[model samples]
Each structure stands twice: as structure tokens, then as C-alpha cells.
Target: MRPVQRPRRSRRVLLSAAAGAAAVTVAVLAPQQAGALATAAVPVAVVDYDSHDATEYAARWVNPYGPLDGVVPQVDPSGAVTLSDVPFKPGTDFSVFDHLKYIGISTQTFTVPKVGTVTFEVDIAASTPGATPGHVVEGVYGPPGAWSLADPDARPYTATVLEGQQAGVVLNMIDFCTGQLFDWFVAGGSAFPLIERLPTSVTGNTSNPGCPGATEVGLDKAYTQIIKNIPLEPGQTHHVAISFSRSAGQSNVAYALDGQVVATVTNVGIPLDQQGNRYAWTGTYPSLGKGEKLADQINSLSIGHGLFSLLDAFPFQYGCSPPTTSPGAGACSPDSAAYSVSLSPAERSFGQGAEGVFSGFRVTTTGR
Candidate 1:
């Protein structure tokens, strides 16, 4: 399949098109600046899901379930995509997954410049009254390794690479049981800040979704010391941005909430496609024509609402499936998994289903 390229647009024009009705709020989650990496105002591509059919912007909406199951998200006339169904359900039998349904949209995958920075940003708002909180909304950008569109069982491109594994980078807002938002980042197998404790109202309650009696999940310290808590309320819109920068002997990715820098991962390598091709930026997947073999970098990226490894691992990693801490302590435990993948009953309740809006999405690039 050939690459689909959209005419370049300035940040001002792109933002205006996706402004919609609600005003976008920018909050600072960390003290460090995003630096000059993403300072460019012109974008390589601007996908206004609010103004155009999301399909027209990229390749496909790939998922295991169909619209009848409500796993397929709807892009309303207002130009926002709404996820309103329970995609996956794991019964009392914790040993196996009973039902697994997921959905996500992607743009035609594009390679990144060798010496430039690539930024992917989106605006999200909780929509469900009681279901939105305790759920996470994700924004992802990175190299897609070993993912193929031709494979009938191909997982979502956003499926995170396990720890001790190298693929790409990921950033998401964890609006866990407390109904508050927290920043989460993982590159390959390494996750930032080690551990992040939600607000007292969340941790204080033993019955909270993913919070059990234990204080340690993966790390040794609390993430609050470096990141701030943002309320995850219905109808409130927040902007999330992640930038990947590469230069001589240095490669790092920075995450920003609203408009402030929150966390940055350093010493990262250049993101490569499955074909061993080096690309700096990837937004969506382009439609693949017959017989095309270029690495399909497709993912449910434009809005990451998918369940494969992400949902499967969320419980054991954070929920402490068997509530064990020692590495490989229990069968299918967080410690045993390379990437954090724990989902408690309460966490599963939230993950079982959710509703939210993605008002806008864009990707910008700047060369050093």
C-alpha cells in the first residue's frame, strides 16, 4: 500500500478545526520543559477526526468485535469518537480469558526523520457518569515491531512491548479506581517512576478497583513526587502530548499533559519497522494493497481503545493477580510478566467497559 500524505497545516489551524464546543484545558504534570524538540508549529500531518471521517484520514478501524457488540467506536457528527461498550469480560475463572473484544483506529504509518523530533497529541474527555473513571485513556507513538495487517490474528499496534523487550514507547492517563488521573509511561520493558500511588481517597479504600492491601506494585517510590494528579471528571477535556527526539548519541521521548512536561525517557533507540527500516514517526497505518510487503505499522493509535496484552496484563501488574511481589512469584503474576499487566476485579469492572471522547489528534515533526 502506498503512503497517504495530507497537506501540511499550522498548529493554529489544526487546533481551531478540532476545538469543537468545549474549551481545551492544559495542565502541567511535571516541572521540566518539553524543550526545543517539539517547538515547531507546522505538522507533518493533522488528522481532524472532528471535521472529517476518521477513515478518510488513515487506513482502517481494526478490532476483533463488531458494531453489534458495541466494541466498535462511533465517530459522531461533532467529529469526536465515542467508545460506549464493554469490549472484554474475564469471568471468575482467572486462569483464562472468557471474552476479549477491542477496537482502535490508525493512520497510514509513516517513517520518522533520522534527526528530527516527532510529537503525537490528542484531546480526551470522560463521558460515562460512573464508568469513565477508573479506566485509562491512551496516546501512543513509536516503532511497531512484528505487527502485520495481513495476519488475521494481528493484535492492535498499540499493544505494549513486554519489559526486557524493545519495540517502541507508550504514554497513557491512568484514571484508576480513585476517579483521578495519573501519568504512565513505558519504553520497551522499563516503566517510569517505578510506582505511582493514587490519591488517599483511592489508596485509602481497600476495595478500590486496582488497589489491594499491598502498597508496592512494581517500583520502590511514589510517582506523585514527580507527577501531579488531575481529576478525571465527566465532560472535562484535557490535551495529552508525547514527543520523540533523536540526535547524535542521544534519543529520548518526553510526555506532556495539557501542555506541560510530565516525564521523559532517555537513552532510547531509533524506532524501526518490522522490516528493519528505521523510522522516527508513526501516526496511522495506510491502506495496504494486495502483495504489498512493506512493514504494516498499523495500530489502533488515532484513539487507543484496544484489548490484547494491555488488558490481559493490567490486572497482574497492578492489581496483583495473586498479590505477589517477588519476581515470577505466582503463576501469571505481575512480577512474572516483563511488562506490568495486572487488572483487579474492580479494575476489570472499569476495564470491562468505558465511554470517552477524543476531540483531536495531530503529529508534528522538526529536524535538528
Candidate 2:
């Protein structure tokens, strides 16, 4: 006689939801194996309102058994924390500091027990929408030497969740001069070659502030999702994940639509040695003039390993604003809506690892 199989509850719910929405749905059947597959399932962490900083819209959520460290700020020369600087209204928005530098929050310390794909997601918003062009929410992965902002390896790539335009953006709950949003970035190491970028757009809202010349909402209310394939070692692979939404979460607005997929990358290979350590970095560039610093606003970051991991959420200052076609029209102003995440053991860890946690997620909005 043949054995009976049980259906997955979550799968059933997903199917029902798809059917109710009148969306095309496809189902695939998996072949039964003699023993349970030793594949590792990526864990998930969700942060609604409670997990973030009410003031800055930032937080750090952790997974116990996962390999993830804390985030930090990129130091400046004046002994003050640095931020990315772009062009914008004085009290209305923030800015990005430099173009090529890596400025945002990071996820350090991750371990892969098997070879598979790693995915990440987060909800993000901005204060002033549709004001600039050079803004972006990017993700970086792989060893320090293996990654690059200018020319990232084919494995670790970037996606533009939102494209900078002159209209249609959304904001967060707080009514400060600025608001907050969710953004995510993903990269596949040498092992996995799948990459993607997801950004949110202005949906169900019709409000325009900040730039009178702009048309779309001044902010976005949505999430950024990332998926990457990674090759693990024979036993385990130590890896890291990081998220950085620069320019007060206002860059790349063209791609900012509700539940839109911005970029996708695939075809990653296997790693030669996976049983090592992993590290990540996130922060802002600190060398620009006073009016060109962006407030780095990071909400929450997570690292998972076999269902155990760590989270850190905090508020730091970088800068913001929309991209400008004019030479000096939309420069970044200091509005204090940015945050940072700092980690220890600057490099990847090979053995047992530890992480720090910072909790706080909030954003202040100005203007009408």
C-alpha cells in the first residue's frame, strides 16, 4: 500500500488568497525522497511598529542561532558622525554625502549550514518624495575584497528599488519634517547567483508637499525584498546580510510603486570554502560640505542561521533630498532624520560569533 501525504497549511492559505484575488496561480508537485532533505530554510523576522524607534524609525532585530553582528556609522574627519548628502529643501528633507562611497546600515556575521538561497525583506518610506534623482537604497555582500560599489562582482549586484523622479512618494506615521519607509537589498556570493531589488511606491495616498514643482506623493509606503543564492561549505557557510537606504529613504523613486519588483539577478555558483566567517558594513560618507550630508535612516536588520539570529535597530543621522538636474538646486540639508548601526570585530568571524543590538524606529516629518 502507498503512504498518505499531508498538505502544508501555509501553502493552502497562499493558494486560497491567490484564488480569491483572481490571480493566476501555478502549483508544482515535489518528488518524494527516501529521507528528509537536509536543506536549510531561511528564517524570517517582521517589525511592525513596536520593534522600531518611535523617534527615528530604526531598530535592530536579532536571530539567536543565526550569524549576524551589529551596524555602525562611517566616521568623519571632524570627529562627528558622517552622513550622505544630496540636494533638498532646508527643513523639508535630507541628502546623500558621496556617490561612490557605501553609506547605510549593515548586517554582519552570518553562517550558512548548507548551499541555498538567502532572502531579505523590510518596509521603508521617506520624508520628502519626488525631489531628487541620485538617491538610492542599495545592498552589499561577500568579503570586503570581493565587493565593490563601482563594479560589484557579477555575484554581488545592486538594485534600484525607487527611481528619483519629481512626483509621487509616500511617508511614515510621524508628521515630522520627514518620514520613514522600508527598503531592502540582496546579493549572491560566488556560490549563489540570484539577485533582486524591490521598492515600494505611493499607493492609496494622494498628498504632495515639499517641492511645489513636483506632482507625485512626497513619500512611499512599501517594503524592499531581496533574494540571493549562496553556495555553502560541506558542513556550513558563514555569511552576512546588510541593508542601506540612503538619502532619507527618498532615492530611486521612479521604481517606487506599491509591491513592485525593481531588479533581479540570478545564476550564482558554489563557494570553494564556506566554513569561515562573514562580515558587513553600513554607514554614511562624512567628507562633504555642511549642506551635502544625508541622514542615514536605518530601521531594523536581521541575520539568521538555522532559525537562530540577532536583530539591531537604532536612529542615526546621515542626510536626504531628491536628485537635481540643476547644478546646485537640490543640495542636502541637515535635518537630523538619519541613524547608524555599529558592529564589533570589524572583520568576518571564523568560529563562534557575538552581536550587539540597538532598538528604536521612528521618523519625523515636516512640511504639509
Candidate 3:
């Protein structure tokens, strides 16, 4: 495939075509403030599910199913996609992922050089209840050296050259289920705060989801202290970008909505001991959201520290296809057809059909 060239854009001008209500602009400023200069954005995945293979995005193969039986996602020719059907009953189970419904975009897992900037940008919108809370968007898969440190295993990316522990980075939309209209949590490593004993109130808290006992505390820490909630136009399609950049001894992540910086999380995790090095990868496989970091690691480039290894161990998938391997819409069974993929008997529908419409996606690395 040819390298997708981003049209040269003038600084101070919108970098991408105006969409929804946003006008995203490229970085432009006085020479002293030029640290934020961005390279041309790369075109990664087409959110519309219609052209599965042609879209340049793929699915991942992983184990450990959510509470609901793990069913493969589904795609429609109209460029729509759907996750496994999950019914909302608060908690019959206390875990965060029990009885869930969602999908991820893997394949062409993206990585950035040890230095510079990489951003995964996409336009997202919920189908049902539309941008309601708890219907949050999250995922950036593993870290470099996921299993061990200094192992040349190429299966996953390393989080840091030191420990090599791995987990996904998730954002909790403020006000679960309702989305509080639109507020999100994006953490920066500068601080570490824990969710103390939470109140049982069903409002402004995660308890409404029926999460109690240990799960409640877990939810609190996950959703709180990491970052502030970014206010967004929940229902309207919005351009969102997750960017990692290091400057002047600081490693920070900026979350942008519709061309404007909404939140910035810095000094994210301490275990990795990133020092001045923080690395990130995007979408290896079996995950959702385009450009969500698939893996990341931190280490010095000037040294000979072989802190991590990576490998494409899992089987590859080029986007989610129609469950039936049939031709088109008619060929594939209706979402209500049977207990196949993308739908479930344990589902409660709020009238959003099928899946989300990700208008566009891309993972771009600048600064080598």
C-alpha cells in the first residue's frame, strides 16, 4: 500500500476537513512555542464498517472473554459496525467487564519512535442512547515487553524498558450511563490518587451500574484521579485525538476534541519508572477504537538497554467481517436472526442499530 500522504496544511488553518461542529487546526505558533509542531496526519482506519478489508483496519484475536460470551463483532455495508450485545442490569456480576458489548480495531498495530510525537485521531459517536455515560470509549492495548523485560519476544510492545508490565489505558466518561452529557477522564502520571470508600448513592457515582463491593472501589480509582473529564458533544460526531509528546523533562498526553485541546494527562504511571522516556503503540489486534495505544515503553535511545521485545503472536484479522462469510447485507443473517455474532438475548436495546460510525481513523508518528 502506498504511504497515505496527508495534504500539506497551513499552520493556523484547519488540518482536516471540517466535520460535525469541529474545525481541527494544525500547530502554528511563534518559533519559541513551536514544540507542538505536528506532522501531517496519517489515515489509518475508516470507521464506517462497510468496506472491512479495504478500510485498512483489522480485528485482534485474544482470550479471556467478558462476562457475556465473547462474540465476534459485525460489519454492515453501510459502513456501520457492532459489538457483542450486552444487557444492562447494573451488576449481576461485580466485575467491570461482565455482560459487556463493544468492539476494537487491531492490525497494523502502530508504534512511535522512542522520541517525538504520535497521535491516534478518530471521529466517534454512539449509536444507542447515543453518547450516554458509561458508554465511554476506551482502549490502547498492551505495553512493550508486556510479559517480561529484556526479552526479544516480538509478540507485544513494551511499556517501559525496565519492568515491561502491560495493560490497556482506559478513559471513564464522567457520570456513568448518562455520560453527564459529556465528560471524560484522561490521566497524567504526575499524581496517584485512589478511590476511597465510595458512597452508595446511585447518582454521580458508578454505583448506579450495580457495581458494589470490591468492584465499586475499583471503579472509583479507575474513573477518578487519573484525569479530568473532557466535555464533548456526545451525540454529534466529533474528531478526537490521543497524543503523546515529551518536552523539557515532561512526558504528557493531550486529549483533543474537535481541534481543541480538551485535557492533558502527564506522568501517568510510576511502576515503569519512565524517567524521561515514555513510549506508546496503537492497535495490535483484538481491541477496539482506532489508534488507541496498543503498546508503549520508555527507555533511553542513547544507551544499549534492550528493555523490551515484541511479536505478532496472535492470528491476524483484517477488520471484522459479516459473521456468515456471506456476500452482502442480505446474505448475512439479520442482527436479530439468531444467537450468532454482534447480538444477544441478554441485551437491552435503546434503539441504536448495529454499531458505531467512526468517520475516520489514523495513527501518525512524528520526530522519528
Please report, in order, the local distance difference test score of every candidate based on alpha carbons.
Answer: 0.33, 0.20, 0.27
lDDT of 2 by residue, 240-290 (tens): 211222122121111111122332211111111111222111111121111
Minimum summed lDDT over a 10-residue window in model 1 is located at 20-29
Candidate 3, 74-149: lDDT as tens digits:
5445443333222223211111232123323232333434334445554444322211333211111222111222
Q: Per-residue error at 98 for model 1, in Å?
A: 9.3
Tens-digit lDDT track of model 1 for 1-368: 11112233355844443331001111121112223333544234444434346564235444423432344455665555654443234322132231223334342333344444555566554322222223342211111111111334433323322221111122232223221222332221122221123323223434554334423222221122222223332234545565545444444445665555655544331111221333322211111111111111111112333222222322223222432332222333333234333333333333333344555666554442
TM-scores, all candidates, are 0.43, 0.23, 0.39
On TM-score, the stronger of 1 and 2 is 1
Residue 37 alpha-carbon offset, candidate 3, angstroms? 10
Local distance difference test, candidate 1? 0.33
1 or 3, greater by TM-score: 1
